[model samples]
Target: MKPRSRPTLARRLASGLATLVVLAGVAVANRPMVAVAGEALHTYQINRESYKKRYGHWARLPVPHDFRVNAIHAALLHTGKVLIIAGSGNNRDAFEEKSFRTVLFDPGTEEFTEVPTPTDVFCAGHTFLPNGNLLVAGGTKSYEVLEADVEHAAGVMKIKNESPDHGDRVFDKGTRLRSPAGLIYLTRTRVTVPAARKVTHGAHIMVHAGAAEVWVDAEQKGDGAVVQDPAQYTIDGLTGDDAKNLYGVADKITREKQEYGGDRTSYEFDPVAERYVRTGNMRDHRWYPTLIGLTNGEVLAVSGLDQFGRILPGRNERYLPGERRWVRAPELKRYFPTYPSLHMMADGQVFYSGSNAGYGSDTEGRTPGVWDVERNRFRAVPGLRDPRMTETSSSVLLAPAQDQKVMILGGGEIGESPVSTARTDIVDLDERQPRYRPGPDLPKPARYLSTVLLPDDTVFTTGGSSGYRGGAYRGEPRSDLFNSQIYRPAENAFATAADSTVGRNYHSEAILLPDGRVITLGGDPLYDETGKNAGTFEQRIEVFSPPYLFRGTRPTMAGGPTEISRDETASFATPDAARITSARLIRPSSVTHVTDTDQRSVAVDVVPAAGGVEITVPKRAGLVPSGWYMLFLIDDRGVPSVARWVRVR
Candidate 1:
């Protein structure tokens, strides 16, 4: 046998270099595969029993195709059913077809039924009356037209009748009016002007003209028909005395953007009958208003765009629930941006949390304050960081209504500016001079985040986007966040929870259910994942069971009084009385667009009785507003029992 000779030095070096190149190529090719494997491992770990028991779990609800809706507004009724309203669902075609919809969902039965919606309640305001009826008021009377889409210049025209003997004058649609420039404009709808009335003085008499306003569009399209200055227009068909008696006046007629017009219709949704009962109409048409139930059982409606597509100038009204009518609240005149977060305080004063849906003048009504509606006095509160980013913020009165503390969560820049903040501010209203103080920051900048107060006294926040309606942020195409966190007020810190599968942003809501789970629904994103196509509304509902629910068996409540009065004691039968540690009387949420003034948890004094527990309701009307509440008994493990419906009088 002969021994083999060694290779040349050049050959050896080439072979070694080839080996290194192949290894580098292999490492580069396996990078994506390694990432996938790591993601799979993390998923499996999170799904394990130990991880779920610690971080909680999320499950999606099965909704039938026939029962699906856009869910613009949602309220949990006293009958343990959820009322979802989608009047036209923000779809212009649906509004044109008058296809309004409302649906009732029973979580226990997992059943859904459609309720006939008579009007377009999209962008309406609602609050719960003392009788447990939900009063829904104001909605979209007309959709907005952008400047680019405006083919004809338009403006509101005031028609005056100066002749006292002419009686009522009627003009049908398409009635033409001619300006001094000879430009013609046609009325969009019929107009009726009342006859002028003669006023008598001690020695003289004067006639006051009667006027009616109607929307009028330019007869011809283009800048030629645009009128920049206020002008008096003559009625085209009128002649001689009729022409002098009736004339049209308009401030401007230009192809500018037109805002959404408001509707004056109102209704009371009867939970027992499962139907909407017609109520008296509001005096002023409103869109994006806030109808908040006062301590006296009346509802105060404030801030919205009126029928003429103009922001109401400090006009507010009150709804008398018993009389079923609305009257102007001239004395309570105060302006705010649309859908302002107004929380009723224990002393009947309302606290404006500085959180509002984007609308109105940016600087005028953006101040945080305590408004004394009775005296028409407002005192501003300072120390709010990133105050300008409060347009889409969420504000909640912290747990234990007696604390009188409010926390404002993440928000974005005014309008659709694509800027967001992670800052959270808390204010103790019980202070002599209430001012906001900074709290822990969120994990990431967020907007339209939904915050739900759980029965265990913890606030669970989840599902928001870092951009404008989940569009673009920091150069990312879409920015809907799935991360969930539980904020422990006691610790003043946030703990990670299991991530949700769905992406929720604008038009989303998180409601705490009677069974100790948070149900989340509705998301209207501006763009899809590719950031090129329009996004669709999220119809799938997700339910979150907190970590406590996965810990062990929950406490059970068997019997309880159906109704209780303020400052009174009530007893209820409970199987796990020994383990029961605390009691919470939580108001069910009537929420939309992160604006829910109806939700506040009242801590009740609990004492263990024979095989049950006794709880006392607070005496102050502002502390516990008259309405239906869910009473939950929490055990030592921080697990809440199934709630029992209890009405507070």
Candidate 2:
């Protein structure tokens, strides 16, 4: 594992209570706080006590031998299971465990099962295929699985270059932690007795448009697999480190400083054939660029910094397979300095968020801005919500009553850099006089956070880069074991979550399990520097769910009990209604063939004030649970609303 810079000092210990609230109630979100965006869904928070745990209440999955957690990546399987694959791990200290192993977690069972971590190369930011499989691409060209004789806890993944150029891939030697390495995809499927294994569906889709432009791994080896020397005969300009120093001049540099690239790479994979094939070339040179899939089936390659490590001027292009031509979008407001986010709304609008560009006081390239998908530029877009660099200028989205209100939950003066503020201005695209709603604040700075829609309308966010990057080689790093937290819809806040007990930084991924639990995997990475402050940390996979979802975890307090009942579909809101201790619902246990969508919708229902309300349950004959079956619960403000899971015997 590469070392990251250590925090000279720790920011005041993350406020626990503050963490819970800031996560949910930020004084202000990203921008256009209150925006008339789309329909609204009831919101809920991920705060509950059962999940908070009392005794040895929290259960951690046992990681494979030798894997120290570098980073963990997660994806939701359509079958209500969350599969996790841990990224490359580095052995930092004799005391610190080695990572780089992968695991799978069954949130409903509150169990963590291990899986296979590709012993080939390091990777992240790969595409999540429409199918359940995950697509990983590029990291170090010198990536090689350690020799079998090496101890599992060994820090070196130095595989013997025996086959040399035939089987498996290799990471570029001396590659930095942030350097791009390998890229591959994984899918999950289920088949009935008579059927040829049909993939029912999945929850872990939606990552920059179904693998657009097939960003080929330029460093991949021919390994005797080459029909063509340089498969595509195309080469990129970003070669990783020379003997351990990627992204900069090498130890043995001539004059004029050395430049990367020239190494042949390919990012092509055939979905149907399940084989990788070389294809087209990128419009220009872009290292670590953001890729977004447009509704019309076109892929957008956003701007990236230049070889000199300077923020390139605003440059973005559109690539469509059929066209084989690159059309330019509005010259980006500025170079997408780093880790830009490209979001696609349900309504077809492509949201392009220009991440932090190096500081520029000049208006033309300074504070970040947004661009609407210029009509005909590529395709028609329903709408686009720009990132607000200014506090008051950003529009905001509010929490709606019915599921029809499209409210803005986050936006503000938060820049792409590490040090960002979370203020909010709500914008109702449909409203004339839209006033922004100022919420709470983040317990600590969060960047590159992932956003997901909860049944109750609130959003679930977790695992992002923390600390502020002052300038070129200066920023804070993630240290210690910190479990990521959940964001609530009702309070419009964020809170300390349970499953985030393991460390993860940079490029880690979180997927919502079918039963409402979150399976987080990947992130066993070191920083660009030989310091311990960069990249995602931890390689262990953990599942985070409300108390009820996982059995046997609750506060055994004698505070009587409050119960919610709904045979088919149940609901409730969090941080409201007596901070959910254990929210469970059950249907007829006698019916085996019976099935139903146990979606839990949470709303504040004021029933006759029984010290604890015992709501009645509903049943749909044999189609539903015949007897009684417990539904999932929320603790730790764990879930903003009720989260449902299926039970089919």
Write the residue-wise lDDT of candidate 1 on 1-649 in tens digits. Answer: 8999987756765765565556556657887555555555566566556778889899999999998899889999989999999998888999999999999999999999999999999999999998899999999999999999999999999999999996999999999999998989999999899999999998899999999999999989888899999999999878899998899999999999999999999999999999999999999999999989888999999999998888888899999999999999999998899989999999999999999997899899999999997799999999999999999899999998899999999999988899999999999999999999999999999998999889988899999999999999999999999999998889888899999999999888899999988899999999999999999999899999889888889999998899999999998998799999999999999988899989999999999998799999999999999999999999999989989999999
Q: How accurate is candidate 2 locally (lDDT)?
A: 0.34
Candidate 1 residue spans exceeding 4 A from truth: 1-43, 200-202
Give the C-alpha miss distance for residue 440 in model 2, angstroms. Answer: 2.1
Runs in model 2 lying further than 4 Å from the true structure = 1-58, 66-285, 305-335, 353-370, 376-437, 447-452, 462-485, 494-499, 522-537, 547-649
lDDT of 2 at 204: 50
Top candidate by lDDT: 1
lDDT of each residue in 282-358, candidate 2, tens digit only: 44544344454454545566544332223346666665445444566654333443334443432344333233322
